[model samples]
Every structure is written in structure tokens, then in C-alpha cells.
Target chain A: MKAFISKNKWTLLLLIAATALMLVLAQKTYYALIIALFGIYAIVATSLDVLFGYTGQISLGHAGLFAIGAYSSALLTIKFGVPSLLSLVLGSAITALIGALIAIPASKLVKHFLSLLMIAFGQIIYLIINSWTEVTGGSLGIMNIPYLNVFGFEVNSNLKGAIVIWVILAIVLLVKHRIIRSRVGNAFIAIRENTVAARGLGIDVQKYKVLAFAVSAAMTGLAGGLYAFLRGFISPETFNGTQSVLFMTMLLFGGITTLAGPVIGAIVLLLFKEVFQTFSTYQGLIYALFMLLVLFFFPNGIIGLYKSGKTAVMKLLSKRAEATRNGGAENAEN
Target chain B: MLKIDHVSMVFGGLTANNDVCAEVHKGEIFGLIGPNGAGKTTLFNVISGFYKPTAGKVIFNGEEIQGKLSNQIAQKGIARTYQNINLFKKMTVLENVLVGCHTQTRANIFDAIFNTKRSRAEHEEAIRRCREVLEFMGIGHLEDSLAGSLPYGDQRRLEIARALVSNPKLLLLDEPAAGMNLTEKDILTDTILKIRDLGYTVLIVEHNMKLVMKVCDRICVLNHGNKLAEGTPEEIQNNPDVIKAYLGGAK
Candidate 1:
């Protein structure tokens, strides 16, 4: 509806402008290489947003889905000689199936229990990747994973890869934005508010819960499919519990409730990671501290801060104008 | 349109509701009344499909829906409000009502993603219908305000608006006038009548006698999880058991 978009005009503008700026800036050498990876992570973070921000559920084992997607996509293409696009599709499908499987139990469990289930799921995937040596190459990881090619054109180069990834991000982001503005989005919010009330209003809470989780996993899996092609390698270490936490941190740092929050959060945190890889050992500690500070002061994330600032500025301007108008009116009456 | 036959709810060893039975015919405002802890709300939950009765059948429009999921019952054209307002606090009042439009609208993930013409039309219809409901409930101007930020009366009205937008065949109100003053109560009575006029069968559980007596076409009295009496408001007023149950002694 126009009302939905009209209300979110500023946010939509900011995201579109930022996205355009990022796509243009992402063509250079150092920028393109890492920014492509950032784009991949952005997709993952947004998917997590659908769970945590919209659905009011948490998945600490999303890294498991990510790993499954990456390994499946790469192995299918490299070993089974499956074509690239089909393998990617298959990977996403398998990840969605796994997501639904986890969701069956995960939907019935509340915050802590659900988180624990996902964490255990992530660890199980890690174990599988570690033990299934002949198939997965175990810790050695999959190598020579093909670059993304469509119809015969290679998009493996850094700039091309960045373009490819951002295109997917653009489409996915728009779709997510539209959904968050529609009936299903409101139903998701209703489920988040009060499950009993949502059900009384005729919303199937459990079904929507699983839907959120599955959609989140599907998004992360799509990113994983892209990541496999972009990096040309796969390892258990890349998708793990730590990575899942980072994804959540990204969602929180950007303002989880906002549509653009996860994407912006991903960009900001990923940029920091690339710029400060020299402190890679301390990244986890830094992330925790940053999240702590965000939780304490800006629980709504950067968007909240921006909104508050805008409100203050508008108030100040209005007050000053009123003061001058009153002064002029008094003088005129005198 | 609703029949509750020998419905009872037991939580562990505690019987929250004993065998309770009542019938709400089409095109009437049915009132459910009782003192505190009398299982009025428990009956509402059983009918709304929130709780599975320990023993009984809840037949709605000829379908046995005792153990069906709450949303399924809602989809069967039954919608209800809570004793405590269960609005989505952060969403706009309009958005809250749009959520009630979930069953009537069909926009799959692809439609949402692509912003298809059909989905867009549906979205517009949802907003338009939400506005109409808000106006009907006397809160059209509060559409953009967050549900949590509205005045107390507005919030209650907003809840009704949300319930009505779903086109419910049976709309159940849990203490719809719990915190209203004289004027708000009058307005609520009028609104309930209007809802009935629009072909909705309303069932209300309330402790507010003034509004209930003014609005309800038939009143069912419950005391200690059991039906004490059922009749028109004047007849209910003369019922000795209801007076004894409410005042702790008969006149």
C-alpha cells in the first residue's frame, strides 16, 4: 500500500541510495574483492533479520545451514559434475528442507531452548563436515570450486562477482521490503507480539514460525551458494557457531526492526572486519563489546539514532521559527 | 451459530471450568456474565479454540471444532479479542488491522517479492478496509499512530476494529468495556449493536452490567464454572441465582 511505502519513505530512500553507492564503489580492486564477500554476508544477515527482527525467533545454528549449502553446492558441482546453477538451486533446496526439519522442533521451543537446538544443530553439521572426509575432504576443505557462470559467461572475477552478488542482494532486499509491508509481514509481527492473541485473530502461529525460520535459512543458503562460487573454496570453519553469532550481531547493530537494518549492519561490521583483519584474533571480543554498547544505549540500532536526531532538529527549527514570529507579532501589536 | 455442549476444562487437578453449555443463535448479541473466577473467560477460550475442553463438543456452523487450532476456528469465521488488549504494540493501528486481513487476502512469497499487480491491489484493499473499520470504530484519525500509543478507549476500539476487519461470523469480546467511562460504555453499546446489524453474531463476556444489560439480546449467567441461568436482560435481572452469585446473597 502507498501508506506503507509513504511512511517508510526516508528509510527506503536511505537504503536505495546506500545500495547504489555501494554498487558503484564496489568495482575497484581491494573494494570489489572484499565487498563481494560483504554482500554475501549481508544477504545472510538480512535472512537472520527475518527470524530475529520480524518473527521474534532466534537461530544460533544458521551457520549449519550455511555450511550445508556451501558444501552441497560446491561438492555437487565439483564431484557429481552437476552444473553450477542447478547445484546452487539444489543447495538452497536442501538447506530449506533442513531448516524446516529443525523448525518442527524449534517452533515449539521458546527462546533459550530454541537457541540451544540451533546451536546443537550447528555443532552437528560441524561434526559431519569434520568426519565425512572422503566426501567433504574433511578439514582440507573443497578446492577448485567453479566461479559462477551463467549460460557460458564467467562472472568469477572480483568486480563481476561483486556485481552478481549485489544484484541478488538488490532483488532479495526489494522482495523482503515488500513482504515486510504486506499482510504476511503484519501476521509475522502479530505472532511476535502475542502468540495467543495472534492465534485468536486467526493466525497460525506455529506455521508462521516455521515459515520465518525456513525463509531465513533459505536466504542464508542462497548466500552460501554465492559464497561458494565467490571464494572458490569451502571449509567447516567458515560456517560455524561463531559465524552465526556474527550474523545476529550484524542484525542488531543495524537496527533489527528496520528493513535495511541487517543489510546496513552487515556492511558496517563487514567493512570493519576487512579493515581490521590485523586484529582478527580480537574480532570476537570487539564484536561482543560493540554489541554490549549497542544494547545498552542504541538498542534500536543506527536507524533509531538517525530518527532521534531528525526529531531533535525539527523541534529546534520549529521552536526558533515560533520565537521569531512571536517577537514580530508583539512588535507589530505595540 | 455456536453450540457449546458439556464443555469442561481441567488444568492439572484444578478444574478451571466445569461442564458449561450455551447456544448463541444467529444475529444476536449474546452476553456471558459472572463474578471473578467464574470461568466466563475459560468458556470464551474453549469456544475460541484457545483451550481444549476436558470433555465436550463445540459445534460452530455444524462443524465439530472442539480441538481444532485457534487460527483454524478463526478461519471458520470466528474472531475474538482478549481480556487484556493484545495489539501489536509497535505496529501502526492500520498495520494491526491489516494483520486481521490475513485470511481474506492471498499474496504468496513470490507476489510479495515481485510486488505483483494482484498483491498490490490486495494490499490497497486491506488498507482501505482497515480505514473503513477504524472509521466505523471512531478511530480513523489514529490509523498511523502506534497501537501502544493510543488512548485507553481508542486501544479498545482498535482491538474491535482489528477483529471486525477479518469479517468474522462470530466476534467474541472479553470484557469489551472493562475500563470505559459512561460515555465510552454508551459508544461501545452502540458499536456492538452496529456490529450485530452488519450480520455479525457477537458474544461478550463482561462484568459491566450497564453496558451488558443495554446491549445483549440474550444473557447467560455463569457462576463457579457452571451456567446459573439464561434469558433476556430483564429476565436475567430478575433471576435470583445471578443476584445471589453476584452480591453473595439473594434479595
Candidate 2:
């Protein structure tokens, strides 16, 4: 089990197989549907990790990008009669542009203050979706948007939806992984560590910060577009400021610096929420309790816990090996 | 070669550098000694393009570098080490040196995306350069060590190696012997001479009277941000103003 887990590529393949098997064995369509939602949220969460975890920028306005994508795709498909697929791509691009625009001012602000501003920006986006009755259907939301299809096969079922969402999430994760290992990634780390030092090394500090924000926004927007089509409808409440907080919390509760942390975080948090649904009315209080526990004990999240455990286990094993070696040497000498 | 002409920097009511003029020829070890708060560091900062002078210009190898950024100056054949040893603590010794080679790398986003041959070549070249610098500094065995874990003397030598990896024509060292013992200072002096032998000019700001006298081709003395005396070491040592400004117990 340890060897299988240590090989990342193998682990990923195993996970994909497990997910497929789980979907096949799932008795209810609703369970598959929840997994599909998890996949979409995981995509956005992982993209958020690219900017926040790797590059060290705190953005609480990602849900705004998500809403931008959802609304654009929805409005294009419903009001303008555009095809769902093209509308989805267009929504992502437009969302990216808006993200770039927002980053222009947002990148100048410091971290904690920037997160506050982002929260305010997220509120404004929600208010626009709520008040713009003529365009956004006035909080009622546009409905009956056509489902996505690739190569003439309509992906309407929950299993197909899960596959589609996972494919996109894989692409996003791949791009993020490549970027993290590149010189651009080095520049991002440099900026994260010491902006003054980065500038002193001739790196364009503002440009990289803005680029990080825009790239993260684009990926989040793409996830949003997919999410809207998957759900077939989107309401203003779906992307409230609270959703932004949840996204940030998910990223943090995972190891903020690891690639796999955000996905793990999203899955764990969503599972908690799903389990809380059994309690029906006290779900919010349960989530708050979980958050407090995470804050108190596992401040670095599950990944950090796993790392410390692995280290302790390795040390114990090495100590035993060293004792055996010493005993063998003594016996040989005797 | 480095040339500073009529460079004057005033900080509000107090002048940090007042019409300071000097030249550092190629392959020469130039010395700058000044009393405390006499703007020796301020002048070095100006030359390295950290503080823009209120007036005058700094030209290096026929290019005006006065108002340029510090990193740009570093890229344009100038490298400097700080008085407090500014190193990337989290990075390994080799990684810290490789970062100095950032300007020499030619791989862009496309190369990085595809992991192309060009990017691999650049990476290999950068590592080779880092190794060469570490070897030259006699800390090649410490390449895998974290920069923060290195001993004090090794840290100073590593700084020199980092600056040298950029292949600068001019190098500025600020107080390279501040905390060193006599043995370390001797090794540092030998290293300074070896660096000068490598065809690069060195401008050093130091308070170590013995090292400066032994290694410098010429010395410039400053007091109250003004040039007080300039000559060979022996001449400056006996000058009256130099005596009053430094080598005397005023504090």
C-alpha cells in the first residue's frame, strides 16, 4: 500500500479506477451526482491552490469569477440562443478578461487587506446577480440551458458528467503542475517569498502577481461554466460571498502548498457537509465545529498530519535498522 | 571600469554623499575608508544603482547606470554583496548560486512548457556554473547544504560566489571582513587578490585598516560625506585630515 501510494502517477491511475468502480456500483443516481459536483469543486479548488498555495496570494473573489462564467454561459445559451459548448468556452474567456481587470487593482494591495477587498468584490458580484432582474432573471436564474456534448454524444447523465468534470480538472492540474516546475514558477515563489528580492533579481514583480491572479481566475471561471451546465441552472445564492469563504477555507484546510492538498480538502469538506445533511437543520453548526477543530489541532491541514506521521515512522524504522547494524557488528567482532 | 562624476545625494537636510568623484579601473582593488556615517555605503549604494543621486551620474563601461534598477545594474556587468550577507535562507547553497544565474538563462515559457532540449541545456548550464562558482570559492562540498546552515566564513565566501556567477565586470563588496577573525581575514584577503587576478575590478568598502592597507592599490578617505583625502595607502595613512577623520579616537 505504501509503495503504491508513493508513486504519484500510479496513485492517480488507481484513484481514477476506484472512482469509476464506485460510480458503477453506486445504487442511487444522486450519489453519482454528488461525486460529479465534487469533481467540479475540486477543479476550482485546485486552481485556487495554484495562486494561493504556490504563489502565496490570498484571493477571496474566486466565486466572482465562477459566477461570471456561469452567468455568461447561461445568458448566452438562453437569451442569445447560442450553442452550449461554444457558450461555455466564451464564458471562460470573458471571465478570464474580467479576472485580469480585477487583478490590476487587487494585485497592488497587501495579502490580508487584499482578501478583504476580494470579499467586498464578491459581494458586489452577488448583488449584481440579485438585482439585474432583466438579464440574470432576477435571482430566479435562467433555466433550461442545454447540456454539453462532445463529438455528438450528449453528456447528460451523472456518470458522464463525472467523467467530463474529471477530464477538465486533470487538464487544469496538469497545467498547474507544469507551471510550478518552470522558471515562471520560480519567479512566483520568489515573489511569494520576498518581493523586494524578486525585484532585485530583475523579475517583473507586478506582472507575475497579475498573471497569477488572471490564470487562477480563468481556471476558476472554466470550472464555474462546467458547474452551471452540470446543474442546468444557477442562482445568485449559488455564488454568494459565503461560497467564496468556503472555497478559501477548503484550500487552507488542505495543505496550502501542496498540489494534491486542495482536492483532498474539497473532498473532505464536501463529505462532511454530505454527512451533516443527515442531521438536517444543524449542518451549519456542525461545519463550524469542524472548522474550529481543524484550526485548533491541524492548522496545516490533513497533508501536514500525514507528513509528520510519515517522518516519525521513518525515524523509528531507521533507528531500528541502526540498532540491528550495531548488534551485528558486535557479534562479528566477538 | 566604474566612473562616478560629481555624484551628490542629499537626504532632506543631511547630505549623504556630496559631490563624490572616483574611478575604479579594470583589474584593480580599490579601497574606500571613511568614518562612521560618512556616506561610504551611500556612495556604494549609488554606484550599484540602489539610491539615485540628487545630482551627477555613474557610468560603468561607457554606459550611464545612475538611475537604473539594482538588478538591471547587476545584469549589466555589475554585482554586489551586502554588508549583512543577503542570501536566500530556505534555498540550498547551489540553488542560491543558480538564482544568481537567472539573467544568463534563455529558456522561456515555451521551453518550460514542453521541457524542451533548450530548457534542459539551460538547466544543465546553470548547474555547471553554480558548481564552478562553488568550487572556486572552496565550498563545493557544501553545495547541497542549506544556505542558512553554513558557517559564517562560508556564508561570506558563498556571497562572493553568488555575485561572481553573474560574470560581472565590476564587483562591490561591503565590509567583507567585519566579523572575521585574523585567519579568516587572511583567507579573505587571498580570495580578494585571486578575484582581482580574474580580470574583474573590485570596489571595497571596509573598516579593516590592516587588510585595506595591504590589499588596496589606492585608498580614498571620506569624512562627513565629503572626500577628505585620496592617495596611495602610505600617503593617506600619514595625511592630517585622514588622521583626524579616522585612526583617531573621536568616539
Candidate 3:
């Protein structure tokens, strides 16, 4: 129990903090909705980190994958009369399959070519959703998507949605943490740091790259499925290139390769955007400037900044302790 | 255990290795030595499956392995270090070695996600093996430190440790003694011999003649991408062609 707590202290603390925030904002329906939205976006950012941060691959087409999940789930529930939970699973699984297919070609390419391919992929998906008026409802997306039902209880309220989303997010984060510390996660990092060395050491780089893509897509797809249920609607506009870029931005802003980075990044950036909605025209400019500033100052992201700050404080404390010890020795000699 | 049969690697008008042929018998320390631009590293690349040879075959344990992917070749029990230290710098030394254990362990995504008993056991076993290898390389205490933070010699040893953890049949060391002091070189020589004593074949490429002569049971010389000499160290040392190639003339 002691070892478990020590290992999971941060996770425990985050859960407590989230629960407290939920209680404090219990009466504010708008804030609760925003928090729920943050949970969804945070899931996307964390999924992106699995590829971009750990595996050192880029995908600007995540918005497309997200759209696939949302549409599939919404359509399944509305048209096929499938249960909400089953649709969510099926939708994410479909996204995972598509992600693996994309990775087959993407894994063979490197750097700029990979990024360009992803951009084209996103554009293609967006175009399909935009023009396919028959099934996707075209620009006019499907509405009144059913809310998630758990054991016959309807998650219709924002508070209940937030609870469900956070629970899922917590599980995602825990699973990610386990994988990162495991042998499989090591292979991902090995590919990221040095592909040649990784290959020489017997790691199947191509296979792992595809695995990273599939896993990342599955998580992002889950987020999209949850988003559709929470908002009761999702349009192609919500999963455009700009939205994809926003997910990347959140990952970068929070810091990549760290679990806390994505959640903090999603919550902070979403809140910031909400606050700046009054100046809607300049919101993009303001966001860009803020990202630039953060990148310039903290290249590793906010978590990195916190880490370095912590080390600095620890260093100062150690130095003070050493100085006091030396002074005491001198007084004894006197 | 390994044969380089008429291997020739040509890169767009430049012959990095021309008709290079050599054989490494199992459990012996084989050395490939030459001056700069002599294609020693290129030949290592060919053997390790980094570059498919323009011509010829690389046979290991009686099976031809040319043109195969590097990871496939590695899975066939051939591990190699780089001329330049290639380590996952940001990762801890233990993590770096654990990656080398990838082929040995087999817990899939489902196992990792669910934290199954098999995954936990495999993980613990991998860690134990990594620790054992680090201890062998004399870096057991530094396992928690980042690979990038180690001193130059330790980084080199860490690379060797990473390679060794994979439990390859043939170990290739590229300039293992490069950038090392005389004492470190002596230690490396001992380590190489010890590795050989453990029934593993070693193929080394080095510029340090003294260490090569001291450690290698046999040496092959390359000049201008062609084989100049292949013999016991004493035979290579006495050969006029080898001396002329090294000194640019027979003195």
C-alpha cells in the first residue's frame, strides 16, 4: 500500500484536485460544461503525445480521425439504434483500424514527408465529410445524439458528463503511464531517440510506429465519441485542420512526454480561449503570440519549467544546509 | 559463424567497399583494421544490414542474410555498436538496456494495458538481466543516470552493455577504444577478451594497432575498399603489402 501510494501520488493528487474543482463549480452549469469539454480535449492531446512526444512522429490529421469517431458513433446511435456505449467502442475501434492503415505508409517516410502526408490525409478526410451530404448530413451535422447511459442511468447533465469523462481520462492516463514505463514504451522512446540504434538492438521499428499510431488514434477517437455525446452534436468544422493544430498546440503548451502536461495544457488553453472570446477576431493572434512566448522561454513546456524550478529550489536548500554545517564546524573549532 | 562473401557496397560512383570477403569463425576475436576512407565502417554497415551491398552475400549460421532489414538481422543474433556512440541520451541507462532486451521479452499491448501477471514477470526479468549486464560493464550504479550524462568512457561501456543485453551470437564493436586513455583501452581489451571467453564471437574495427594486436586472434586489412591482407596478427604485421599500405612505402 505504501509503495503503491508513493508510485501514484501525483495521480491521486490530480484526482482529488479534480473532484474538489467539480464540487466547487457544482452550481455553475456553464463552467461544468467547459470542464467537461476540457476533459475531452485533454484526452486528444494526451493521445497525440503518445505519437509526437514519445515515438517522435507527427500527425496533423488527428482532427480527421476524431471526426471519423464522432460521426460513426453519432450515426450508429441515431440510424442503427445501437447502444451509446457500444457505438463509442465500435467508433474508436474503426478509428484505430484507419490509423493503422495510415501508419503503414507514414512509417516508411520521415520528417517533412511524414508531416505533409498527414496534412493531406486530414484534408482528404475533411473533404469527404464536407461533401458526403447523404450520410454525414454534409455541413449540417446530425443533432440530438443520445447521451451516454451507464447501467440505465442517463448522463444527460453536464456534471454527470464531466464525471464520466474525468473517470475515463484518469484511466487513460494510468494506462499511458504503465505503457510508458514498460518495455513496449521503451521501444517507442528508442525509436524516437535513435532509429538506427533501435533497429540495431532488434526493435521492430516499423511495427512499433504503426502500433503508436493505432493506440494514439484509439484514444483520440474515444475523446471524439465522448464529445459527440456531451455536446449532442459534432460538425466537420469541429474536426478541421485548425482543430488538429489546436490539439498539437495544447500538447506543446502543456509539455510533451509528461502525463500532466496534456491535461494542464488542455485546461489552461481552453480557459484562455474562453476568456479571449470577447476579442474573437484577434483570438488566433493572441494564441499564437502566447505559444511563441512559451516556446521561446520553456521549450520543454510548462512541466519542464516546473521540474527545473523544483531542482533549483532543491539545490538552494542543499547549499544552505552545507553552509550551515561548515559554520557550525568552525564555531566548534573556535 | 559469419561469412562476408564477395561483399561490395557502391554508393553512386564511390566504391565504399569493393569485393570485400572475410569469414569470422565462432568464439574468436576477429579484427578489421584500416586507415581512414578504407571502408572498414562501411563493411560493418553491410554486415549489420544498414546498407544492402551492391553485390555479394552475408551468411550467418549457414543462412544468407544480405538485403534483410537491420532489425531482422539483429533478430538473427548479430548485435553491433556504432563508430559514434548512438544511445538514447535522454533515457536512463537501465531503460536503454531494457530496449536491447526487446527481442527477448514478449508482452504485447494488451498485457501492458492490463498489467497482467505475465507482463509484470517479464518486466522484472528484463530489469534483472539489464542490471546484470550493467554490472558486467561496471556501470551498475549508474543505471539510474541518463545515458547522456555519463563520462565518455562510461558512455562507450554503456553502449557495449546495451548491445550485450540482447545476447547476440556475434558482437560487433566499432572503434571501442576510440577516445579512451591507455588505461581505459587496457580495460576495454580485457573486457573484449572476457566477452570472447563467454563463447560469443567478436568482430572489432579499430585504429589502435597495439590494442588490436593484443586482443585480436586474427586481423584483416582493407585498403582503398579492397582486401590488402588477411592473417594472424603476426603474419599481417610482417607482410610487406600491409606495411606499405600503412606507411605508404616499404621502409
Q: TM-score for all predictions?
A: 0.94, 0.88, 0.97
lDDT per residue (tens digit) for residues B1-251 in model 2: 78889999999999998999988888899999998899999998898777899999998989899988876876787888878878777667887787677667766655765778878888888899889889988999999999889988898998888888878788888999988889999989988998988887899999999999988998889888898888899999889888877667545
Each model's C-alpha lDDT?
Answer: 0.87, 0.82, 0.92
Q: Write the per-residue lDDT of candidate 3 for residues A1-334, one digit (tens) a residue.
A: 9999998898799878977977689558888899898999999999999999999999888999999889998898999999999999999999999999999999999888998999899999999888899999888888889898877979999988988998899999998998888888999999999999999998899999999999999999999899999999877888788777778888988999999999989988889889877886675676687679778999888899998998999999999999999999999999
lDDT, candidate 2, at B75: 71
State the weakest 10-residue window (summed lDDT) of model 1 chain B. Answer: B106-115
Q: What's the i-RMS for candidate 1 in angstroms?
A: 1.1
Model 1 agreement with the true structure over A1-334: per-residue lDDT tens digits: 8998999898789768976886687777677877788888889888888888888998888889999889888988998999998888889888888898889889999899989988999999999998899999999889999988877878868888888888888877887887777777877888888788788877888888888887888888889999998889888889767788888888888888776678778988888887898998887797898799789998988877778889999999999999999999999999
Pairs in steric clash, model 3: none
Q: How should the candidates be ordered by DockQ, best one leading?
A: 3, 1, 2
True contacts kept of each: 0.77, 0.24, 0.87
Q: Model 1 segments beyond 4 Å from truth?
A: A1-28
Model 2 docking tier (incorrect/acceptable/medium/high): acceptable
How far in Å is the alpha carbon of B31 misplaced in model 1?
1.2
lDDT of 3 by residue, B1-251 (tens): 89999999999999999998999999999999988999999999998999999999999999999999999999999999998999999999999999999888998888889999999998999899999999999899999999999999999999999999989999999999999999999999899999999888999999999999998999999999999999999999999998899888855
lDDT at B116, model 3: 97
Residue-wise C-alpha lDDT for candidate 2, range A232-265, written one tens digit per residue:
9889988986677677777777767777788888
In angstroms, how far off is A66's CA in candidate 2?
Answer: 2.1
